[model samples]
Target chain A: MAYNDKVLEHYEKPRNVGSMDKNDLHVGTGMVGAPACGDVMKLQIRVNDAGVIDDAKFKTFGCGSAIASSSLVTEWIKGKTIDQALSIKNKDIAEELALPPVKIHCSVLAEDAIRSAVDDYRKKQKGGVNASGS
Target chain B: MNRVDVCWSCRGGVVAGEGFCPTCRVIQPPDPRRDHFHYFGLNPGFDLDLGVLDTVYRQRQQQFHPDLFVSRGATERRYSMEHVTRLNEGYRTLKDPLTRGEYLLKVTGFREQTPENATPSDPAFLLEIMEWRETLEEVDLKGKNAAMQLQQLRDRMMETCDAEVVTLGKGFHDWFVGGKREGLAVAAQHTDRLRYFTRFLDELDRKSELFF
Candidate 1:
């Protein structure tokens, strides 16, 4: 039950905690949940014209570990390319947060959220309104 | 507890429904390996007759009463303790609809936890969750109509959760009775929804507390 200092720190003062225009073409939304713990997380990234993550935000409803996990990832993904953001592993987040073995799933949820967000962005770019029917 | 067919003390054959060995009249340990339905001597499925379950539970409780073992041997007393423990635990698990479905899923070889990809695949469900969460955050606790609004939301959420439970039951029935594999996935998805709904209700309770 005891959380590490880093987790507590991020949880108490989560950075970039908000929402973006999900309908905007540049915005990618990732919604993930852990059924076992009943935790829901929504992570979003707004990619700039340069194909770099201009801003990232998240809203998580769960334990401190979950909130910290998403909060940390949102901060990490900012200014990075979508590919770079995709490379952020759950292990790295868990290691950085010093999350306990049981809380490792929180980090995994964050990683999945990022991947999902990126996938959404790619899908939007591919066949949606952006498609020119080539 | 592992010796289901043979008695530990008398080494005699133990018949089904016989708590004590027929040959030596010694209490036999309850089989720990037995599934909950098997423990209750019922068919494994989602739909259960609560009356039958209640009757069996009461009968087993009386048969394995701890007081009945006090005058018996040390081994018999130990077996009695084990029987009562597992009986209570099993009865509690099977008595609840949600827990009962989950237990059936476990016995049917479904993973209890989420997989490596913990994110829910259903975008619609995710959007609903997010919107509900946003609504929860948007409610002003200091407003005069806050209590009424909270009650309305709670009622709506409770209705949704009740529907999910029904769907979950049907999913289990389809898998166990109808012999459909896809039913397992349906049960799993609804179970996930129920958990989220439960959490949302808990948050509602917290918000109500803050309002009051």
Candidate 2:
């Protein structure tokens, strides 16, 4: 299937494609995969103490859809509150990326990655690495 | 249809006291009596013996390979080709444990791929997946040792996957023999793990290819 223009654009030049310090309590990282197609996606966010996302980055290994999905989400999550980032859904990513039915799982993987990264950030906050254990 | 053991010649007498008709010296048609497991010369069990399966598959392919009949008439060649095709399909289905379980379920008229049936029951597995992904992202940014560390991590993940496969085999046996409902759930869990392992391996492969 022909890719959406936006998806093709992001895939060609993915934004914020790097990782921050794992030891940084403010950074949350997530990795996910779709078993059916053997795709892997990694997403990370740097959140301030106030839970406002300051930065986002991603890396994906799969088809164009997967690359676009991660790229789009990384763009979406930055500057948003943790709550807003958590609400991002696979359908939105799929629609935005114009992913075909077979590639919907790629969007799901992206959503999963976002949730995972947020959860990791929360865990680190609770564990007293970056933030004092509340 | 004539029973495969009976000979048409000698008034349906057993030829060579086995498969041949003694009176006409005619060889009987190949037996269609074998089930999928028996056709591959395996015990009728859910647990697969992959070594034996591979050996039998190779042997069967060698024996009935279409190339062997290429010089023969079109009819014989077509028959051989069909046999080879079926053999390959059957081998593929039986080789993978999840596919094998599904095939058995289909054969037994209990074919079901419901979401509940295919989903993993353990919530911890999902949590584990999340943590692993976090570690992967951490390593992705590390320039020099990133590829090497990813390979080592992937090797460990594959070892875990191999163990899961073995556990899946046990679950299959339990399901087939004990009619345990949980066997299906276990099978589904293993299927998920297998997919994750495959994805991780593919990632490592991509990184290695780019570096080298």
What is candidate 2's lDDT per residue for B18-55, written digit by digit as tens? 32356665433334554567667677656777899899
Model 2: chain B TM-score relative to the native chain B: 0.69
**Residue by residue across A17-97, what tens digits does model 1's lDDT show?**
999988888999888888777788999999988999999999998889999999999999999999999999999999999
Instruction: For each candidate, give its TM-score against the true structure.
Output: 0.89, 0.64
Q: For model 2, how does the per-residue alpha-carbon lDDT over A1-134 read when each residue is reduced to its tens digit?
A: 68889889988998888767867878887766665555656688999877799899887767788888898898898889999999999999988877888778778888888988888788887787544533
- Provide the overall lDDT of each model, using Cα atoms, as 2-decimal numbers: 0.86, 0.70
lDDT of 2 at B155: 80
Determine which window of 10 residues in candidate 1 chain B has minimal summed lDDT. Answer: B111-120
Error of 2 at A25 (Å): 8.3
What range of 10 consecutive residues in model 2 chain B has the weakest lDDT sum? Answer: B114-123
Best by TM-score: 1
